[model samples]
Target: MPIAITGPNGLLGREVAKVFKKEYDVIELPHDILDITDLNQVREVLSNHMPTVLVNCAAYTAVDKAEEEPKKANLVNGLGVRNLALACRDLSIDLVHISTDYVFNGNTDTPWRIFDVRDPINAYGYSKYLGERYLETVNPKYFLVRTSWLFGIGGPNFVSTILRTATKQTELRVVNDQFGCPTYALDLACFLFKLVKTGAYGVYHVTNQGITNWYDFAKEILRQAGINIPVVAVSSDEYVRPAKRPKNSALDPFPLKETVGSLPPFWQDALSRFLSETQTKECLD
Candidate 1:
């Protein structure tokens, strides 16, 4: 059976398509081709493709912007997901929806579990939480995978941002207070492919095995690139944004491991591999 992938042009979706293409007949549907917000459009695509799996990688990811545009975020992240879930439920197809660690309030000192009571503080997080709830109630065959600090070749992520800034400045100041796992999109894509094949239909928190703050992540990026730039550690208050971020969003993939057998490697190892694969030369020019 074919697998329909929404947001096929996105960072994670692109990687997922690449891997899934090797095994299954992968259907790439972009927003321009099929806007998920429209219920009719979603049903049309589902009926046309008749895919066995629907992987939803599309979302309104602008965290700060969501604060001002909650409605827009809900329409895309919340309602869009609901549409897909309902369609899949009717068709009896498995729904693999990508989620985020922001679902947690970030106050917990320990890693969060799959069953953790989500109390998101930001608009983006709340929108995702709503999507999760909709999928849980609406679809029985669903894999709600929550990830964090994602960086890959396709998108403008934190790793790329740090590399860009480091090229211009000799020293950089990053937030040391906010903690989370840095997940490589390619790694996550591979894991998701394995997960769907296993028929594990439930919530899972998947990320690289360890945790680190943005400062540490930046330092590792520079080190991996063989750069000598000095990255300074600063508190989250030093660099304020319109939206509030969780102080700690690290999640435990123990349930995922127990169910899926294993997970991706540690963050540092994954970062090094990503840097090597992309060969992003830190250049100011």
Candidate 2:
């Protein structure tokens, strides 16, 4: 049976489609084609596609802006998820939904596990958490995959932002307080495919193995690109933003390792692969 993927135009969605296209009948649906917020539209798409698997990559990911636009965030991340879960339940289809580390309050010094209690710190996090809860409660066949610090070729991401700034600036100041694993979209896509094929349906924390602050991530990006820009580190207090970040949000891979029998490679290796595949030399040139 075919698989229907929402947010097909986004970074992770695009990668998922690319990876799954060879093995499965992949149906790519962007928001312009089908807004998931509308239950009727969601039902119609699901009915027409009649997919065995539904991968929900669409979300309201504007962390800071979500505070100002809580309603829209909730509608897309929370209600949209509920609509999809209900439809999937009725259709007896499996669901693989993408989530974020923002679901945690970032208060814990240790890495977060699947069974960890979630207490989101921001509106965006809360909305995503609500989606997770709804899916778990309503749907029996679901994979709640939580990831963080994602970047890829299809969308503007942290790596691209840093590369762009490094070209024109001699020095860059990055936040060093917040810590988490940086995930590559392609790696995540491949892992998701394996999970589906194996039929290991549950919440799994998928990301690069090592954890680092944003400052270090920026420095590594510049170093890999052969850029000579100076990436200086600054505390979160010095570089304040509209949204609050967790001091430490590294995810533990005990469940993934135990279930999947292994874990994804380190973040640096994934980043290197992404740079090689995307041929980011254009950006440096």
TM-score for all models, in order of appearance: 0.97, 0.96
Task: Give the per-residue lDDT of model 2 (tens digit) for 89-169.
Answer: 998889999999999989988999888999988899999998998899999899999999999987879998998888788
User: lDDT per residue, candidate 1, 1-285, as tens digits?
Assistant: 799999998889999999999999999999998899999999988998899998999999999999999999999999999999999999888999999999999988999988988999999999999999999999989999999999998887999899889889989999999999999999999999989999978888889989999988999999988889888888878999978999999998968878878889999999888887777433421
Clashes of 2: 0
Candidate 2 segments exceeding 4 Å error: 280-285
lDDT of each: 0.92, 0.90
lDDT of 2: 0.90
